[model samples]
Target: MAKGTKSTWSLRRKLILAAIAVVVVLGLALGLGLGLTIGRNGGSDNGNDNGNAPTPTGSPLPSPTGKLPWTPRVNDTWQIILQNNIELSDDATSVTPNVSVFDVDMFDTPKETIDTLHRLGKRVLCYWSGGSYEPGRPDSDQFQKDDMGKELDGWPGEKWLKLSSDGVRTIMKSRVELSAQKGCDAVDVDNVDGYQNDNGINLTEQDSIDFLSYLSNLTVPLNMSLGLKNAGDIIPSVLPIVHFSVNEQCVAEGECQTFHAFIDAGKPVFHIEYPDNAGSKLKEDIVQNFCGDTGDASGSGGFSTVLKKMDLDGWVEYCDQSVETTALNSTDQGS
Candidate 1:
């Protein structure tokens, strides 16, 4: 994990977590973001997060709830963000970027916007910070001082949450329920990899795995899909429970190989990589490696990869060098 350039200061922030695929976390340190498979009773009781649920005792086995909503498939193209609300195209038969999915801010987006994406044949994944506390989210007041620890470096107003806390688990369960109510096909629970960082909560790898199991229970009953965001080490344990995985910088950090479990298991690894140098255009070699790391032990043949800037706005460039800019509303432009 040698250091990278300045535009990738975000990359450097992640490299600080060396070999842990900490790249997606730079945005976790901020936002750009980004589902579940599940059972009915893995965490707390249904729709009953009083911010006082118990720690997940091993994941309840995956018991199909008769019907499941759209679980993102392997090789599904997608985009992600949390800093702003996504604005879809007005055309009813067509969608901007025309990707199979759009992963965006959960609370910030209106249900009408999600409904619009649905009309255009897209599965929407709502993003929520599941492992950390942000000062501005609608549920900010619910977090107690003892429930959280140190702020995420380089990202203001964000702190690593105590994953083992019964109260914190309840808040996360509430969020999963919200995603279902808002019509999200899946929920992307970010920052669950806090155990891999300097998260002051002293989180452990098992803590993350257990928390993921807990999240799965909440969505499975609703029939909403779910994804594990970049806690690669726990993939083996949670793979049966989650629908897919949302990853950051596995290519750049050379850990793309580790997520083969997701691909081999017939699930998607929604992967992203910021360039070694930001601001500079995507160099030919960089694009070649990210999209074409094919047919090898390290080659990620089935990953749905996207090249994005650290901010994770609508602008996206694919492996083929084609680019699409989704429209951003005035409110999303920091206006």
Candidate 2:
């Protein structure tokens, strides 16, 4: 009976041991399964940056800690071609006339072209209309019907936009975001001067000031610069935040003095004068008529002026009589 009791006790101990061993094995399997499941669900709680985050694509644009935005200097030379995309060979080492900055249509220009320009040590100013709606733009439909006003004079299929509309502001913000994404050094926001036109929206100078302030807030954090395009009346209000002024025909309209506030504030005035005789190389007299820094060109002493045709094609002539025609892929839209 004692021997039988000893054998029974040994068998009970084995069974207990086997049960404990099986529990241990099952607990380990459950722990491993939970670990893998958490990992698969992006719930890893390791509390460490394991470098497994999803990588982002596209060019590295400005962040809160990225490099400061490019600031253009007074009297900096520049070229603007809005009619089409500027063509550049991938292997080419230089651009024509080799100016310091090129303001091209943001949508029309390819990222490769902007990259090429950067490789050539040139800054790019992406152009987009902020206060006007144009058909055929990718974001054109995004604007509400009530956000549009009368058609812009001389610009077919383009209409003035209400500067106060939230939808309009949203679209403009996206355009600015696009400029930053494209690695553009600055953005030339055009048609902010709708207050000066017979816009159906009755936009006032105060509206322009508020709109520019809004744009400044977006651009400053993105490390991109903002430019006021032909909104001279509100210069004093917005000049502190605006980095530059893209004044069109200021020399012709006796308004260079007004836009020269940018120059006086240590900012650039990228002045353009559209001459009727700009299709070909301008004569010395015609050059003097616009670049003389007197009469209509008064207060343009420090302006970085360019002579172009009314259509703003690739043909450009500088004050010093130098001319260049940027090669284009020949698309029919402005960015």
lDDT of 2: 0.82
lDDT of 1: 0.76
Which candidate leads in TM-score? 2
CA lDDT, every prediction?
0.76, 0.82
Predicted model with the maximum lDDT: 2
Error of 1 at 224 (Å): 0.9
Each model's backbone clash number: 5, 0
RMSD of 1: 22.3
Error of 2 at 247 (Å): 0.6
Per-residue lDDT of candidate 2, residues 1-335 (tens digit): 99999999999999999999999999999999999985554332222122332211111233365433557877689998888778798877888768999999999888889999999988889999999999999988899989899999998989999998999999999998888888888899999999999999999999998888888778867877788898888988888777788988887788888987777667788988888768678889889878887988888888898998776777889988988877777763222
lDDT of 1 by residue, 38-112 (tens): 333333343322222332233354335444444677788887766577665555566568898899899999888
Superposed model 2: Cα runs more than 4 Å off: 1-63, 66-68, 331-335
User: Per-prediction RMSD in angstroms?
Assistant: 22.3, 15.0
Error of model 1, residue 109, in angstroms: 0.8
